[model samples]
Target: MNTRQSRLDVLHSLRERETRSGYGWALSTDVPPGLQQSLQTAAAQGLVELADREIRAELSAHEGRPVLWAARLSPQGHDVLTYLDASPDPTPNCTPPSADEQVIELRPAQMDALRVYANLGPVLRVAPADGLVERVRTAYFDRPGNRWRMTLTTEQIDSVAYAFYLRALSGSVAEANWFARKYGVTYRVDPATGRPGAVRPRARTVSP
Candidate 1:
């Protein structure tokens, strides 16, 4: 018999062991009992992801039925863990950063909630541009040597969009075209759908 580990414990362990962009620990290998359940629960809530032997969960989703025996912290899980370690920040000014137009629009208070997902997920950073104030670009690193790549899941992206009263999917051409009109927002066509959307480069990652 094995003791049941709390969800927090499992998440912590996962993050410590597998925080990289493309790695996973096999749940069936040396993981504790009930870990698979915990992982599944987290996955259902957009925390951990259950993948096949190779950790190619995304490809399996498009290819066929997946084996899903490996597990790792999802982008949201990383963000959740990261958020727990930090205090809530009040610097968003109730507006999401418009850099790169990649991260989903974060509400004033909720904006800082998921910054961990994409290494601060487009949090507004101010800098000097030719002696003038300027907005920091998404994935911009303070040091050129600190770049560590990371990416968010489509579910994570869509969730943020929907949370801000927008949708990643446009049902009609008119709706797609109208996306550009929101708050003076510009539209970009998602390569997967070729439909206009309010965000772009949905697969880019950020790391500190």
Candidate 2:
């Protein structure tokens, strides 16, 4: 079994208990040895916390290590689990996106007008391609400031496109417009109307 997979299972079990009992979940001593490492790794990832209490004194005495009793999912952990569970396949590849590609995958249904506070601070809310969500989340949560910099990829574009830098706050979108034009991508803003851009078919006049 994959260590990360086991860790997620453990978290799910604990989370279930918390949901039913209205209390924090504790680690059971009956846990498999293979899961011990996974538990530690989860804790390191801030997904779970280890308790210092001595619930399994006998095991600690026999194993020459302190028994970890309490463990509960952190807020971020909950969000991550929710995100992962919603995926078609929960097993994540966890591969980092290429630095060269800089386009966000937009849902094919409609390219809605998106607003960003700053020219560089826009975050696309659409679903990313396979294995890309986790990487984006990690980079986003790990960093400070409203400025998020990473390569955005979309199914609409080819694989070789590079990533772009985004900033926060809304003002003159000249930079955004320029970037969109530079890459031959469409922006929701119309230069003439100074409003949300829309696609309209060519006007046809009826015979007089």
Candidate 3:
């Protein structure tokens, strides 16, 4: 199995537990000592949170050895998992978006229409035939680059996804709908004009 895939699986299992039972999910349930040992590694990497008692006990026993994980994922871990959920195994092909909280994939039509968006002439410099998807996976994640990709966080998507949608609308309804479906962008019908316009992002965060 892939290295990160196992860890992601382990973490996903933990997340499922958290999803089902909140944070009180038991960490001592795994039968294999190796699996338990893997937990320490996850904790040491800060992907999961472990109790102080476990930490103290492990340190005293191993004295700088690999730490075992038994807790749920941290906020950063959760965000990372969402941002990195791409195809063909657990290998993440996209770089984490810069200074942001999400990364949304862009459809081809939106990519075309977004080029004509207002004042973007000086923004997107490299209109690669593939639209920087390869480069984004391996290199840059600047504001313009991310926006050009439509790979944005919730706030950025809320504001920019709409403009691109409108721009696409002028080109093709199919393209506009494709973009809207990607982010589930919603509209409020204007009271007087009764036209569906503007954009609203579905809540991606919730308070516990």
Task: Evaluate all candidate structures by whole-model CA lDDT and list the values in order.
Answer: 0.46, 0.47, 0.54
Model 1, 113-194: lDDT tens digits are 2232223334535111121112212223323444311122343444333323322232333322333343233345567788
If ranked by TM-score, best first, what sequence of candidates would result?
2, 3, 1
Between candidates 2 and 3, the TM-score winner:
2
**TM-score of each candidate?**
0.32, 0.37, 0.35
**Cand. 1 Cα-lDDT:** 0.46
Q: Pick the candidate with the highest TM-score.
A: 2
Q: With candidate 2 superimposed using the best TM-score fit, by how many Å does residue 99's alpha carbon deviate from the native?
A: 38
* lDDT of model 1 at position 11: 85
Q: Stretches of candidate 3 above 4 Å error?
A: 30-32, 54-69, 85-208
Residue 57 Cα positional deviation in candidate 2, in Å, after optimal superposition: 11
Query: Tens digit of lDDT per residue, candidate 2, span 106-149?
Result: 22111111222111223544323443443344332112333323
RMSD per model, one decimal: 18.9, 11.9, 17.1
- Total backbone collisions, model 3: 5
> Highest lDDT among the candidates is held by which one?
3
* lDDT of candidate model 3 versus the reference: 0.54
Q: How big is the positional error of residue 11 in model 1, measured in Å on the Cα after superposition? A: 1.1
Per-residue lDDT value at 82 in model 3: 86
